[model samples]
Target chain A: GIQVEQSPPDLILQEGANSTLRCNFSDSVNNLQWFHQNPWGQLINLFYIPSGTKQNGRLSATTVATERYSLLYISSSQTTDSGVYFCAVENIDQAGTALIFGKGTTLSVSS
Target chain B: DTAVSQTPKYLVTQMGNDKSIKCEQNLGHDTMYWYKQDSKKFLKIMFSYNNKELIINETVPNRFSPKSPDKAHLNLHINSLELGDSAVYFCASSQVNPANTGELFFGEGSRLTVL
Candidate 1:
């Protein structure tokens, strides 16, 4: 089984600030995704980046498949951004297309 | 319209009780999954179905059974639930693409509380 570890287990930032979250996987992955679990317990898909970089408004993500790591960036964060950010990956060795998720980085953006 | 939807957003039951959570996805995806998130907010895949066929079954107990009557629906039934079973259950769906494994879209979680 592949292991997914997210850094900065917890983060707090003032509104309008910028932050970065990191995820490291123990093995090569065929699929990688970023998700945001809002305070309402809704898991929203942020990005699906397996090996490249992509930006979605104030949120962007980059995955270095060779390095087995990914970075998620949030710029000019707003108070509504408070929640947990998760990084999930599907290992190449995995039998099915199930994703193994990281513990997640809890983010708090205060206005 | 919701891409993925689960019934009974919240459930409260006593230990040993049996309950069922229903999931449906209108995204026309071929794969559906059930995930559990514990109090620590750690998410883990429990089961996955591709085109109404069981594809991935983790080390989940037999008490937890998942049924996919069709590709668009997957239901989870828990029998003799224990206190430890209390957690948020999420239903997700994705389309398998040749270019890469599909990205998962999760529904608003169903929070279960076992007394």
Candidate 2:
């Protein structure tokens, strides 16, 4: 089994601020995705970046597969973005079958 | 359209009861999975099925059984549940391909409580 670690287990920010969350894996991965779980407990896919970078609205993510790390950036964060952010990866050996998730970074955005 | 949907979004039962959660994916993905999110918000894979066949089975207890009748459906059945079994269960589906990042689309999650 591969290990996935997320930094800054908890975060709090005022609305309109910016922040970055990080995820590190213990091995190489063929599939990597970032997800945001809203207050209503709905999991929304943010990015599917096994490598390279991707951006969507105020959310963006970059995965440096060779370094075994990925970063998620939130620009001008909003109250609706206050929730848990998760990074999950599938080991190359698994053949992109299953995903191993990090503990998640809990984000709280206040107005 | 709801890409991935699970029935009984919330479930509460006694310690010795048996319950089942049903999941269906209309995305037509070849692989479906069951994941458990604990109180600490740690999501772990419980089971993985590819086109109605079991593929990945974690070190979960035998009391937990997952059945996939077809490619579009995967159901989880828990027997003799205990208090420790209380957690949020998520049903997800993805297109499994080694050449691409298999992004999983998850359901709204089923919150299970054992009293």
Per residue, candidate 1 scores C-alpha lDDT tens digits across B1-115 of 9889999899999999999999999988889999999999999999999889888898999999999999999999999999999999999999874434578999898999999
Say which candidate scores most in DockQ. Answer: 2
User: How well is each residue in B5-104 modelled by candidate 2, as lDDT tens digits?
Assistant: 9999999999999999999999879899999999888899999998799998999999999999999999999999999999999999998844344879
- Alpha-carbon shift of residue B21 in model 1 (angstroms): 0.3
For model 1, residues A1-111, the per-residue Cα lDDT tens digits are 899999999999999999999999999998899999999888999999989999999999999999999999999999999999999999887735699999999999998
Q: Per-residue error at B22 for model 1, in Å? A: 0.3
* Regions of model 2 farther than 4 Å from truth: B97-101
Q: Candidate 1 regions off by >4 Å? A: B97-101
**Candidate 1 TM-score versus the reference:** 0.97
Report the CA-based lDDT of candidate 2 relative to the real structure: 0.93
Q: Residue by residue across A1-111, what tens digits does model 2's lDDT show?
A: 899999889999999999999999999998899999998989999999999999999889999999999999999999999999999998988775698999999999999
Q: Weakest 10 consecutive residues, lDDT, candidate 2 chain B? A: B95-104
